[model samples]
Target: MRKPRRPDVTTLELVGGAEALELELHSYDERWASSYLEHRRRISDTPMAGKIEIQHIGSTSVPGLAAKPIIDIVVTVDDITAEEDYLDALVDAGYELRVREPRHRLVRTPARDVHVHLFEHDDPAVDDYILLRDHLRSDAEDRSLYENTKRRLLSKRWDDMNDYADAKTDVIAAIKARARAARGR
Candidate 1:
């Protein structure tokens, strides 16, 4: 239960812009699932995997949705704020810690393609991500709406990846609302 350590970033620029420039949405690739499986295997082989809960999320996880071809994985750990617990192990596994913010920690492969989001176990954000992913998996209408929104916004060059992600917030919130309401019924 040690506090998370700030990433060793002297060697790299803060990643938002450097990372965003690398984003280019592509038509859904069937290989994304296989890629996820491969990543899952690699991650599972790591010492931290036993304590980590992994899942494929974001548009890349949704079949038929256009995405950046980078897989988004949500990993729940005992205490996301405690990076010392797993950061070194993850780094050893070839993942570099990228963003470290309250409530979230991110790591990515050397190529900066796959994003691994770490949340504390039982964090609501984990539920939100999984809920949206599950909802999209089952609801074609919302899925289409989300995909259309992304496709429309993808052409713009964003200075920061967060800006691009922000553009989708409204749609994501709306869809999540609907999903919540449906479950309440």
Candidate 2:
């Protein structure tokens, strides 16, 4: 099976201009989960409620993991390419559309404290997000490794958030490899 890949930054169409990228990492906070729940409720209140699948993914979803303090949500819709199905409702709920790319769409709070990623229900990226989150939640070693890697990467300056994300690709791939192996897949 082919590994899911993030679209190159150049290929992404930014809905608004590029968002400011902050490299700060905060210690895990319990409030992050609540924040996700709040946002999830907001999304649920939208017309897209029953038609989509939502999961809290990324570092913030894992207890004890240091993260950037942003709640990352992965939402699987019936068709990611059909933005009209969900995008307008999300924007009306106050999330600014920040990115559009093949198989992916991103909306974030104006404060940039929460991000909702939309993908097709069958997208491998959705599974990858959940797998990595579950692995980090269950495995201390990989969690620490990922946290350390993030801390180390913070020392460098990145022109774009995607650049910072790209820097972590190798570590993430390695961890996901272990996760898949442990799952006997």
Candidate 3:
């Protein structure tokens, strides 16, 4: 007998559409951070728990960073389709899958107003994000370094938010390398 086929987990695609990501600036606010946790709290109550590990990531999670003020949540799961068991729950909570990065096992929020980054545990992207987040939170000097870079970049006019994101890649990659060395990862 032949083995059963499974849904491919390595075909995740990026969120690329005409949809412009609003990369604006906002003063730090605890309320915004709290909302992220609050949203997770509600998510905990959803049926998605069996397949999802939700997280609050991105600049919004980093305190004192001038950001677009959107909450970035990382929902870790073994499989996005497996979470169909909780699809209704996510919808009830007002989250729609936007980006589909098949190669990376990720799905972003359909609406960027609140960035929901979905990923699987085995995915390197999840670990990379957590490592960077922890590295930034624990080291004030590094945080300042990142903030300075961001400020410098934000000062310039951009064609769109995508351009802004691409520009940060170089600095972020360098910082992540340092972060890995510091943590011995």
Candidate 4:
């Protein structure tokens, strides 16, 4: 018998169809922080006690970074493959599971505004996200470059949200490499 191939976790497929494909970028909003805090608090209050680390990540977390109004959050779980451990509690807390995979799980609020990424403890993507965010926040030149690149890409009609996100990979990678090098990692 042949073994089943494991699916790739890094590549995200297009979701939500054409109507959801509309990517709207907004000027930096002060409320983003509060929104994150609220979600964090809500999640923490759940039964998952001591099993999760919730963080406000992505473009929305960076002050002065223009981004889609959606709040992107990263929730580090004890195990990614064990969704049943916390999925029920999270759903009860108001997050609906959207994407379920071997490496991660994505959940969103009722309005589909806040995105929650669930990864296992010590996942490299967590560090990558934090590094990029911290780098962009502290380094003005790179921040400007990223913002400008995003602004330029925003005008193009993308087939889906994944396409829009994938389009920014090169710039993100370049910045991430510089960030990693600066840290001597």
Best by TM-score: 2
Candidate number that wins on TM-score, 1 or 3: 1
On the 0 to 100 scale, the lDDT of residue 33 in model 1 is 96
Ranking by lDDT: 2, 4, 1, 3
After aligning candidate 4 to the native by TM-score, how far in Å is the CA of 153 from where it should be? 1.4
Candidate 3 residue-pair clash tally: 8
Worst lDDT run of 10 residues, candidate 3, spans 1-10
Question: Ten residues in a row with the worst lDDT in model 1?
Answer: 4-13
Cand. 4 TM to true fold: 0.88
lDDT of 3 by residue, 19-48 (tens): 444355777788877889887887787766
Candidate 2, lDDT over the whole model: 0.88
Please give, for residues 74-159, the per-residue lDDT of candidate 4 as tens digits.
Answer: 99877665566778889999888777655668888978799998887688888888999999998888988998998899888887
| Residue range 109-146, candidate 2, lDDT tens digits | 99889999998788899999999999999999999999
What TM-score would each prediction reach against the true structure? 0.87, 0.91, 0.80, 0.88
Q: Model 1 lDDT vs. the true structure?
A: 0.81
lDDT of each: 0.81, 0.88, 0.69, 0.82
Model 2 alpha-carbon drift over 4 Å, by segment: 1-10
Q: Between prediction 2 and prediction 3, which has the larger TM-score?
A: 2
In angstroms, the error of model 2 at 12 is 1.8
Task: Report the error of model 4 at residue 145, Å.
Answer: 1.1
Off by over 4 Å in 1: 1-22
Model 4 weakest 10-residue run by lDDT? 1-10
